[model samples]
Target: MRWFWKWYLWSEDWKVEGSFPYHLKKMVIIVAPHTHWKDFILGVAVRSAYRFTYVKFLGKQELFKPPFGFIFRWLGGTPVDRRNNNNLVEAVVQKFNDSESLVIALSPEGTRKKVEKLRTGFYHIARQAGVPIMMVGFDFKNHKVIFDEPFMTTENEAADFERITNFYRPIEGKIPEQGLMHF
Candidate 1:
């Protein structure tokens, strides 16, 4: 599978930047410019190419049902009930605390549509879990997946967000118009 994705990415003219930080056991991976469904495919392919089997991603609970449920699970999908007041951050923090090694990826935009601002859940989760946040840019225009260095959160949210915004602002998504255009 890893070789297949390596070949596929090359065949598709896509490039992955930055190496995986294998030293870290637990961290939140924040993927930006998630403006199309194909982003998931690219993410999975990159994960395979890197042989990063510890990675997991949250998805709506509905996606965990029916014919494709097993496939999602096999691809490292963890079902999340977004509708419930589940104290998701705390739950994830507990998961981090209990596990010796885990890496979960999340999209700050939380959707493929254009948003006024990003959802700060990933940051909060990283802060609460006492883990660093790794930023990954899915730049469709450049055909590159750029990974930034792992960042530890400070007391100031605005400053942190400003830094994140600046890092992701230049990356264009598959649907360019729906990409992160603002902080």
Candidate 2:
């Protein structure tokens, strides 16, 4: 499967930038410029190409039901009950604490729609779990997956957010207009 995905992405002319920080046993990966549904496919492609199948993600409960439910699970998705007022951050942190090593990738936009700000869940997850936050930019314009250096969250969230937003401001999403254009 890794070979297949590598060939698939290579055939598509997609490239990855930066080095994967394998030394970090746990991390909260924020894949941004998530302006289209196809971003998920690219993510899986990169994950498979790198043979990083241990990386997991959370999806709505609805996606884990019926005929297609098993597919998400096969892709390392954990169903999340979005309708309920679940303390998701703490739960995810608990998962990280319980496990010796765990890596979860989440979209900062939280949806395919355009947004004024990046979601803080990833930040909180990384901070509370004592894990670094790794930024993955799906630059559709450049046809590459750019990985930024991993950094641990600090006491200054506003300044950290400013740095995060600036890092993504120039990247182009599949839908340029719907990408993170502003902080």
Work out candidate 2's RMSD over C-alphas. Answer: 1.1
What TM-score, to 2 decimals, does candidate 1 have?
0.96
Per residue, candidate 2 scores C-alpha lDDT tens digits across 7-86 of 98989999999978888899999998998888989999999898788899887788899899999999999987766768
Q: What is the alpha-carbon lDDT for the whole of candidate 1?
A: 0.90
lDDT to native, each model: 0.90, 0.90
Model 2 alpha-carbon drift over 4 Å, by segment: none
Task: Count backbone clashes in candidate 2.
Answer: 0
- Please give the clash total of every predicted structure, in order: 0, 0
Task: Please list all clashing residue pairs in model 1, or write none if there are none.
Answer: none
Question: What C-alpha RMSD separates each model from the true structure?
Answer: 1.0, 1.1
Query: Judged by TM-score, which candidate is best?
Result: 1
Local lDDT at 103 for model 2: 93
Ten-residue region with minimum lDDT total, candidate 2? 78-87
